[model samples]
Target chain A: MTKSKPLPSLIAVIDIGTHKTVGLVGQIIDGKARMLSFSERRTEGVVKGTVVDLEKLHNCVHEAVNDLERVAQRGIEEVYLTIAGPSVAGERVKGFVAVPAHDGKVTARDFNEAMLSAKRLEPPAGRATILYMRQPTMLDGKSVENPVGLQGKRLEVNFWRVTMEEGNVRFRVNMINAMSIHVRDFILASHAAACALISEAEKQGGVLVVDFGAGTTDWILYFKGHILCAGSIPVGGEHLTNDLSVALRISRDTAEDLKVRFGSALHRETDANQTIWKDGDKGVGDQQFNRGTITQVAALRFQETLEFVRKDVLHQLEQIFPGHAVKLDQNFLPSGAILTGGTANLADAAEASTNVLGLPTRVGIPQFEKEAYRKPEYAGVIGMMKAAIEDAPPPVRRPQGTLAWLKDMFRF
Target chain B: MNLFTRLRQFFSPRRDAFMGPADREWRQLIPQDVRRMPGDELGRKRAARSRLPLVLAVIFFATLGGIVWVSIDDTTAVVAGNGALRYKTDGFYPVPDLQRLVGQGKDGAAKDVAAIKADLEMDTQIASADVRRRGDGSLEIILRERKAVAKIASLPGSGPMVVRLVSPEGVQFSGAGYPSEAIRNLPEIIDYRTSGSGDKATIEGIEVAGPFLLAAQSAYPNLYREWSALSLRDCFGAQEDSPGSNLRVAVRRASQPADRPVLTEIVFSTANWRNELAILSRLDLDGLLRRPGITAPAYVLKLSIQNRTSARPVPEPRLVPATTR
Candidate 1:
């Protein structure tokens, strides 16, 4: 904030997930995010989205970022990050201000006053607000797109605020800072993923975005074209793997393999007597597991995770629209629910989401010019890149003097 | 929804929580500097790191090669005296002398230049000289001449009054080789300044007189040129640290035998010639000479013991007519 830097063309994004840390380089060319370099490494010492061991996470980050920088032939100084931890939460806050202009026309100053007033509304103790998305503005109790140059006695602004635990944010920040890089901003992994997968039309209508990461499930509700509610559930694909291990008497690693190999959420829809281990995928474990049993163990845990996400989102929505049967309203999610993230690739993940939420559901994958970008796993990083550009300040054009103009013209 | 699943979800520890030592190993071994130089952390590592040794090798050899080339190469220099290669002192330093010394080969060029400088500086005409060799294979020899600051005027009835030039360093030489006009313009050293014919040697007591003449001539050249001669009788305040001896100076008109000389004598006990000469130069000698009833061929202008000027015309014999009155 104390200095001005030249605008950079290459955008670097780091997505630290529970199982994998991804670093990618891209540039906005012709209104498309074109991937330049991409790198991925197994994340270490991170549980869910929280980095418990700073050093392990730092190495994981360094390996991925270093490889990307090597391939790009340039160093990265500043980057945007997508973080998902149990500390993520959201709140709806509002503020109002009287017009200061003599003619009662609203100005930027009035809008800023309202915004500051709303943000200063006490956040939870030991927590800091990281992001805020503005809702529709009200000019003298009348909703308007732009209050500027409009006659209004008072102006009010609403914000959906995202706050994170101070200690966890610091841990994530230090992991990146130790590598001598600057964190331009921290975005929630779900928001970033949703930004990538959700279309503009889907966002404008009501929709639900669920990013199923390895250790955490992040869900955000978009109602009336605004981010109405968002929450992070401390349960994800890893929990289902653990359940499968405990129920089937298998190692956690073997459980993960089983979950990836044969786990399906729509277990009841498949043949219950189908044998899971008949193909002899491994020579060491000679036990046969019925397809129904694999589904029964994994689906139970995955179903529980979906239930938690649904319950938390409903609770937040009820707080917003009190005394109103919000779910009963037919236009709750016109675009339905869109799922993404590492766990979103799980078999029958959409079916489980649809059965629980009672809405049309589909797995989301971010599409870009590079084929590597069009996958659920890449949704967070690509979306973070898109969001970072949107939040960047416009480039400054310095007025050139006569001498500078001549020098520029004659430069070889 | 059983108690087992609830407890497991509540107390699930992050994976690899016990691998602190392993993480430390990676932290220590990671190549922190993988980029190049002259850029940010990444840029510097990328640009400067991998080929650093190769770049250093190139720089080291380049410097060593330049030094070796300069040490072995033969540099020519122009040898000159004053502003030109030829000097007023003819045959002072010819090209053969330069070629014989510095042109032998590329070796010992510094020694050759020093020898040439010492040889030219030994000439009486040259006060100091410099011999330098340049980087472009050339040599330069510059000479400085000691200007004639004082003149020895021959006494009257001394065979047409020949003039002699005294160097600023107090060496007196016959003015036969110099133009008369230049010799005539110098401040004169009159009585007590003498030399045997063809001696070409300086008169004694010039050490004190030489600097005084030089400083006076430089400061008051216009006035110094008008004077016929500065009588050097008893100058230097006697010999051998003799204090309290009076030094008498008489400045005479320039030589134009048709006109009688304007005579003025100043006596001083100190060699404060600068102040004394400045005061003397300001006196209107021509105005004083043309004053009414002043028809004497010589006069004495004494600087009083207190350093003041007072004049007296020389006494003339009265003529008596041998006739019956």
Candidate 2:
């Protein structure tokens, strides 16, 4: 064999989403994500993040994995997995209790206990399951952001508990494990999207993370460094693309391309003036459309979705910030809203979400010191990697014989 | 090369008929007007152009011997001989400090060279090796590597692994570290004993006792892909498929495990190779030979080879009509 130096470590995420499975491998070199290779395979047997056909899902993962292995020329030992679906649900819970009589101060252990107690609000038997346990703020005595080192009579933890189905989680893990890769950790799609796109200050002050994924639009509200509440609507970018496909009588791919290139949330009367070309074939296939009309069709669906999200969010915001009495309109962005996920790429989506949510909005692009880690799509995986790296303990090396044996014999 | 030659022959005209003594008479068989086919001015011009390159080739070849005698003699070896080999040495495999090793050969110089050569080759069994001075006063050496007991199936391809060997005691050796002209002779490993566990080839099952080789690789020296068949015997009771056995297995095609596909064979390797071979040799392969309509068998045969080591009685042989040997 030719003597060549061993290749560098390249991590690839084969995100088997509802619409597509994206296989992207990157090497984290010098704390920077350098892209080594990428591949995309059509996903099947996956509905709203739940796998319907085990074999079909396996095939999709296999194709992507095979392609990545061919490109990277290395074995994939493990993967950081992300999951999102209709089964997933999120809610905010705050635990409040007095400090111990002796300590006279709230400790980190107190915060952890509060967080765990808050997570206990939702059980695993019935509802899907917890995707992530995100703790943002600790309330000590009052609504203090950081409760550490603070003397207080009572301590409270406000966090979000993201849950999905146990069956779905099992199916996904089994599928991944069957591929001979370990799932180091699991992260909720919303939290991952939020962590990737939203700034620390925004999360500390107040911010909302909206992930318009394939099957659901997940919204996570953060305030005072804690997850206030989370919700998901079945309507998403797929619905808009479907609307365009149906209205224009075009193939799904063409509708998607049109939606990506020309479709916008804000529709104008002048759009009807511009015409789009269609092929000479009948409705069966090969057809063109008025580009403006396609845009209008896409806008109608987008507006309806925005309105739906607006009503749901407004109701929640009214409960939390009753003094403010926020009205979601076209005026400004949500103070805490950051749009992310694959559907977040919709042209002017962040601005549109801002317009509807009535707060300052920014496209949630993952902010990592690394370049490859800066994408919204990788938010979940990078977050999982971050958690693993932070939580990982230093390696302990065992001593060999001889000196070690002498040391053992002469141990004091 | 043969495929290309056949392709050329297919497109070329037939020469058999034209080689006849009365070939012109055969031409007259077509028509009188065909004989005067080149009568037209266009035909005459076409004939002249076709012969131009042919004439230049003959003139060029006439002075070829003279050119060769004047310009090429001692320089020919550097030009057309082993020049490519010399270039390949620098381009591919440059020697790695031969003199440095010679310097390191302090205490038993010849013995040190022999030991170093063995280590370099990854081969343990060196039949004979010698390090001696050459005509140029430089050290010249000859070495023979250990033979390959088995050709392991490497991932993606079955190549480099040909240089590896596994002793009877399961110690793996390779010739990767040595430079030798002749390949060492090794015993042919036609069959292997695969168990639930071990450092052999294992495909799927996680529980193993002896080497389980899913596929032969350098990492697994005990197994190879060249063997036409494999017989797993002498497995431990834990690796057996008997009623009282802890290990139970059902072999079926990877695609359809329940349907009991004949293409996929299941083996319960409980202990040693002897028992595994006994189980295989006892198979009713003759009964199922060339039988059709054999999609998949429920279970072909259950061997108690592994059970022999235990106090348990040998299990009954379960036969399937669907199985064709």
- Estimate every model's Cα lDDT from 0 to 1: 0.68, 0.54
Worst 10 residues of 2 chain B by lDDT: B84-93
Q: Is the docking of candidate 2 incorrect, acceptable, medium or high quality?
A: incorrect
Candidate 2's TM-score on the B chain: 0.31
TM-score of chain A of each: 0.89, 0.78
Show the lowest summed lDDT stretch of 10 residues, model 2 chain A: A387-396
* lDDT (tens digit, per residue) of candidate 1 on A215-278: 8998888766667788889888888888888988888998888888888876785547687673
True contacts kept of 1: 0.00
After superposition, candidate 2 runs with Cα above 4 Å error: A1-12, A26-34, A108-116, A119-124, A127-132, A136-141, A145-148, A279-288, A315-336, A364-412, B1-325
lDDT of 2 by residue, A1-412 (tens): 9766444445556556777777666665544455566667888887665677888887787667667766765555556566666776665566776677485777888776776665555444444443435555545436776676778777777655565565666666666665555554455656656665666676667777777766667777666665666667777777887888888777788778888877887677887787655544555655556767876777777767767776777777776667896755423233647777667777777677666767766777765555854666556555544433333321123474687656655553
Tens digits of per-residue lDDT for model 1, B58-175: 9999999998885454442223433233222322334554444434435643456777777655555556776666565355655555678777755456468666677867665554
**Residue B294, model 1, lDDT:** 64
- DockQ of candidate 2 against the true complex: 0.01
Once all C-alphas are superposed, what RMSD does model 2 give against the true structure? 34.6
